[model samples]
Target chain A: MNGVRTIFGREIASYFTSLFAYLIAAAVLLITGILFINNIGRSQDQVAPNPAAIPDFFAFALIFFAPLLTMRLLAEERREGTLELLLTSPTSDSSIVIGKFAGAWAYYTIILAITFVYQVILLNISQGQTDLAHALCAYIGIWLYGGACLAVGMVFSAATDNQIVAAFLASAALFLLWIGDRVGEVIPNINVARFIRELTLQSHYASSFAVGLLRAEDIVFFAGIIAVMLFITIRLVESNRWR
Target chain B: MIEVKDLSKRYGDRLAVNAISFKAQPGEIVGLLGPNGAGKTTTMRMLTGFMPPTSGSAAIGGFDVVEDSFEARSRVGYLPERVPLYPDMTTEGYVTFWAKLRGVRQPAQAARAVLERLHLDDRSKTLVRNLSKGMRQRLGLAQALVHNPPVIILDEPTIGIDPQQVIEVRETIAALRQSHTVLISTHILSEAEQICDRVIIINQGKIVAQGKPGDLRKKLNAANLESVFLQMVNKDKRA
Candidate 1:
């Protein structure tokens, strides 16, 4: 536990200190902020616009954001030889994995918090017209979805010492999962389509959380993905000793 | 205390460390003297618990490096061929991070004290990226010693530093001989002759000879370990 805290503290401090993290934050804010203003800036003549589109679109952008956030977490360490220090230390491999994943997640959370300014604005502009439950559902869904994506990126980061390769692989994987529902629609069999749909990240959060639906199984889906990715990452890091 | 028996490491078809065995009793400075690609790094990695032996066993303070890895690792501090540094971290922060990972009771204090010992206290606030090569080498030593582990494993501890700094590091390591069992790998025969209580001359993944420098000097009727090394290798045509 002390290992976890120490690693976590260092990671968080590094994130705050590095220029890359700020570049990422500025980029996310630019995109999310633009989308927010564009939606609310819609004309009076148009049909009532769904304000939830901002967070939903942000979710689609996570195909890139999460990987960018996590690409350097392990890959850079491995390339720079710092991973040897971590590996040879007394700390358990699992603690190292969890601490890094948490560090990235916490930074993502701060990004999420910054983007929440849009929600606050949405609530203020609507003056009770906005569905608070709807926004809350979307927030919950995006948080877990972000964690899953970061965890996936972490696995790739551990797989190679190249940060670019890690980020590209994670993006490729997220892109496939993002369009999975569309691919499912073209399939001939209903059972196979349902199974594919069940596996797509977009299907889980966008369908349920975007419109104010919060099902237990949907939460489990994201949690399951996060847990499995984290488990695989821990194994990859531990392989330094045996493999 | 450190003990290795029949330790072997295979990377695919090649055997990087081929069933070599050695021991370092309490407070002895042992040198693994060899040229590049002599499996010194691989053997040191196995001893530090960074990698498992492909065939045999190693122990630190009675704890097996593989089976009791956590305990074994907790007792040994390792510095690899390349210094493991986070360019973003301050010198103090870097050592403290390693100390905490090693579960030291007072990480910051330990870091400061180790830095002071290495004559690096004034530079503690500098980012690791800003450190000179010699300072980086000493920082590596500081991180390895911050936890004050029973066994210290250093791979090429003075490979890149200036001669003056190398002398300082050698003295620091020699001082450690009073309390810590130190295993250092070096390609410089003179270095081994100067600081090591015993020199293990290894080549092509196997130890060609090992004994105190004086004993091997007289045994081979050579002026230094370098010629002794040449006599043994040239006379036997050993790999």
Candidate 2:
């Protein structure tokens, strides 16, 4: 537990001091802010606004932003040879993986929190018509979704020593997960298509939590993904000892 | 104390370290001398528990490096050839991070002590990226010593540093022999002759000779340690 805390503290401090983290945060905020404004303008000319607009935008942006935040978590250590020091220490491989994953997840959560300013603005503009319960659910949903994406990014980071290669591979994997449902729509068989759609990240968010409905299955899906990715990351890191 | 028996490492059909065995008594400074690709780093990695040996075993402080890795690793401190440091962190921050990782109760105090010992106290707050090559080498030593382990393994500690820094590092290693069992790998024969109490000369993944430097010199009928080493390695090459 002490090892975990030490690694987590150091990793989080590195993220705060690095230029890459700040650049990713700024880009996410700017893009999400623009999306919110566009959604609000459309809402004024139509019926009640879709409460899922901001949450949906945040989730979509995470496919890019999460990789940017997590690409350096392990890859940089390997490239600079610091991975040797960490591995030779008395700390367990699991603690190192979990600590690094938690650090990246915490940074992503901070960026997610910043977007809530847009939510407060929306609450005031909607004049109490916005369902506060639905907004809160969307925030919880996006937070879990972002955690899952970051875990995937961390797995790729552990697989390579090059940060750019890690980022590219993670982005490709996240892009596939994002578009899985759309690809499923073109499948000819109904049962197979439904199975593929159910596996897509978009379907889980759109059907359950994006519109304020929280299902146990959707929560399980995100949690299970995070667990599996982190497990794979641990294995990847442990393989260094054998090599 | 350190012990090894028939340790071997094979990297995909190529034997990087052939079956070899040696030992270092407590308070001894042993030099692992070899040419490039002579398996010096591989042997050190096995001893430190950074990597597992393919066919043999090693123990540090009487704990097996593989079966009792955690305890063995806790007893050893290693500085790799290329000093691994987080460039963004200050010297103090970097050393403290390592001290904390090793479960030091007072990490800040331990970090300060190690830095002072390495003559890096004045640059404690300087970023690692901004440090000169000599300072970085000292910081690397500081990180390895922060845990205050009973055994220390250093791989080519003076490979790329300036001559003055090399002298400073050699003195530090010599001083460590008073309390710690030290195993250092080097290709420089003079370094081994100057600092090592005993030298084990390896070539092509095998130990060709092992003994006191002075004894080897007298036995081989060589003018100096370098000629003795060249004769041994040259003999291996001819065979």
Best by TM-score: 2
RMSD of 1: 1.7
Q: What is the lDDT of candidate 2?
A: 0.91
DockQ of model 2, rounded to 2 decimals: 0.82
Predictions in order: lDDT: 0.89, 0.91
lDDT of 1 by residue, A1-243 (tens): 887898889889999999988998898889877777777777245645465676687679899998998889889888888888888888888999999999999988888877877777777777767777788888888898889899999999999989999999999999888898676559988889888888998889878987889999999999999999999999988876665
Candidate 2: misplaced stretches above 4 Å? A125-127
Which regions of candidate 1 deviate over 4 angstroms? A43-51, B236-239
Q: What DockQ does each prediction reach against the true complex? A: 0.76, 0.82
* Chain B TM-score for candidate 1: 0.97
Candidate 2 to truth, TM: 0.97
